[model samples]
Target: MAKWGMVIDLDKCTGCTACTTSCGMENNRLPGENWQDVLFYQEGEFPSGTLKWFPRPCMHCENASCVEVCPTRATYKDADGFVLIDWNKCIGCKYCMIACPYGVRFYTDEKAPIQPDVKQVFKGDGQRSWNPPWRAPDSRDDWKHGVGIQPNGVVSKCTFCYHRVSKAPKGTPDLNPANPALREFTPACVVTCAPTARYFGDLSNPNSEVSKMIANQRGVRLRDHTGNKPQVYYLTGGAGGAVPTDRRGKKA
Candidate 1:
């Protein structure tokens, strides 16, 4: 069995937010939604200051706190290791959102951030800005939008492109021998990154690329103390936008 996971090398990340943009467009998220957002903030003070950034996606934890708290079993883990939500079973209770430590989940009907620059919202397009690929006028009975069915009034989060991954034939080869392309098996954010900072593959196989990276680079998962056993790992070694200390004077 293959357990899908990801590794993000912070040393190669540029904090350009390409992953965020590609994730939104590929997932057809609302104007305010950011499924793969990057955390960028200033740290330290005075001359020692530096800018640090972390790209955040659904941790897809092994324990999956969201699944445990859901009354309807809307949040569950698949055999492949991704924490998924079934929109049909979701009762809009938001239990999963509250339980999630990473704060990555979102409700579908919340007020989308206004984009006044777009002239008018949707104009005359359709019901939602982007109709889900699985949607048919006659059938709307699926439990969740993990496959792009993001129904209104449900909590939703990243699915690691399960729809795409599910389509690939069994025993998919390693994707990291070279830079992965925007293929059906690759997540949009992974392929679109200019810096090649993100990697995705099966974690169960010790020889898999993601596993190798985790072992070789000393990758770490955020808040592992929670013991959710997040599959996503990050390798940190970059200067993190460090600048030289003052050699001359100060004040402008």
Candidate 2:
């Protein structure tokens, strides 16, 4: 009965974009299709102003707007508190995309390469995310919990790396403080954060790091007026920064 969530310490983030890169490779995202992004904005006067960066991901709201407007129920919240998209059920209507206040969703449109570079992102679990188009006659269908590069015309966004979090040890935090693994038991964005600006844990657990961060740092969610209740929390320190509304993974 764990509700998974993340905390992005804005004070610690350096806008290095390791999270975005890892997410792209792990999820096999295209050039313009960014599931994780660092939203940048400038505030105040030019010379006296400041440049700030906010690493943006899916909010995974308690009452997600995307889920509410999905005509086909393709976008839904899982029992574990993660909002997800069922690719098979998605009808390419773009309703969920419109409903998302963060503007994080992207309509996939033939972004896959003709012959995917092995050096690029994975297409299956063993090799890549899903079998290439050429594998149609004998597609690899056994990759359980699979989410290959989304087909054309479907809107897709971050899933909080649901595939990894689901396998975490029960009752225990996903990323072990004593022995954290960069390539296991965490979302690609969280694990690859070089500065360790991100933290993910079970929010329902009072003792979890995420819960403690929110309590200790007064972590705030984005766009409070929307009443979306984003699970992702931010702790702003130093100068703090403004997040760009169109944070669509503009090449990090």
Candidate 3:
């Protein structure tokens, strides 16, 4: 079995947010609930100030705190390196939210992150929070893997596009968007990256691009001190898009 992972080259990232847009559309996310987000920060002073952006996604940690704290076992990590949420098992306790150091988890039922709630605009028929008109016809409600539109009370976050990635050809080393055949199985965020900053592949394979990048390019994980051991890695060119010392003041 392949241990899936991602490597992002911050030097190449232009902070275009195309990844964010594609992820929201692909997953039928509500406004302001972005699975892939570009976080901006400023460094230095006055005239010498430098503005940088960090693309934030679920760390998919090997030692995931979310999985550890879930009282209902709603959150789990698989052998293939995916950290997923089982919406059916979830009880809306938000323990996973509090446990996540990345703050990538979301509970849309509480308050609208943006004005003029879209859920109110397009109400769902039953348990679904909203019925998006433009929802993908092929989209499946595999709540076990955290795919599809979330029901009223469950928490949601990035699943490394499990609905699509799970369908990739067996033994495929990398899911490069540039490859026409693999495009269909690639994650929406990786496919839409304008600068080709994102890379996805099996971490266990020493030959995989993701693994080689981490070895050669000096890739780093966010908040690694927490011992979450995030699968996602970043390659900042030591300039723009540098990781924040503290994304939020408080530690998780």
Candidate 4:
């Protein structure tokens, strides 16, 4: 089995929300529930300050605290390095949300972050939170894997576009969007990255691009100190922003 992972080159990212937009379109998320979010902030002070952005996705931690804290066993880490939620088993207690240091989890039962609630505007068929005019193919609606719009009361997060990644040919080393053959199987955020900052591949394979990038570029995981062991890694390389250093602050 391959341990899939992602490498993001911070130097190459342009702070555009293409990744965020594509993620919402692919996943049928509500207006404010962005599964892939790009965090923008200013560094330094006055004229010397620079605006920088960090693309935040679920870490899909190897040792996921969310999985450990779920009272209903809704959260789980797959052998292939995916941290997924089984929506069927989820009870919306938000324990997993509390457990995640990255603040990537979302419980959509509250008022919409945007003005009028879009979920109410476009009501879901039954248990689903809301029904969009269109949606991922029927094949993508697997609650067991948390692939579709979450039902009422369940939490949701990024799943690395599991509907696509799960179908890649066996033993595929990487899901490179640059490769025409693999583009369809790649995550929407990665495929739409205008700057090509995102890279995904089998981390366990020494020859995989993700593995080589980690080894050569000195990739670092976010909040590694928290011991979530995020499968996602970032290459800051001094040109882009450095890894977030404020450990005392909560995610905005």
| TM, every model | 0.83, 0.81, 0.95, 0.95
Candidate 3, residue 147: how far the Cα is off, in Å:
0.7
Ranking by lDDT: 3, 4, 2, 1
- Per-residue lDDT tens digits for candidate 1, residues 21-120, read 8887677666567888887777768798677777889999999899999998888998878798887688889988888989999887655565652214
lDDT of each: 0.74, 0.75, 0.90, 0.89
lDDT value for model 1:
0.74
Task: Name the top lDDT candidate.
Answer: 3
Assess candidate 3 and give its TM-score to the true structure: 0.95
Cα lDDT for residue 8, model 2? Answer: 89
TM-score of 1: 0.83
For model 1, the superposed segments whose C-alpha errors exceed 4 Å read: 117-120, 123-145, 177-182, 241-252
> What's the true lDDT of residue 210 in model 2?
90
Candidate 3 per-residue C-alpha lDDT over 148-185 given as tens digits, one digit per residue, 9 for 90 to 100: 88888889999999988989998899999899999999
Q: How much is 237 displaced in model 1, in angstroms? A: 1.5
lDDT (Cα, tens digit) per residue for candidate 4, span 67-141: 999998889987778889999999999999999999999997888999788888889878788888878776679
Give each prediction's root-mean-square deviation over alpha carbons.
6.1, 6.0, 2.2, 2.1
TM-score of 4: 0.95
Between candidates 1 and 4, which one is better according to TM-score? Answer: 4
User: Candidate 3's error at 72, in angstroms?
Assistant: 1.0
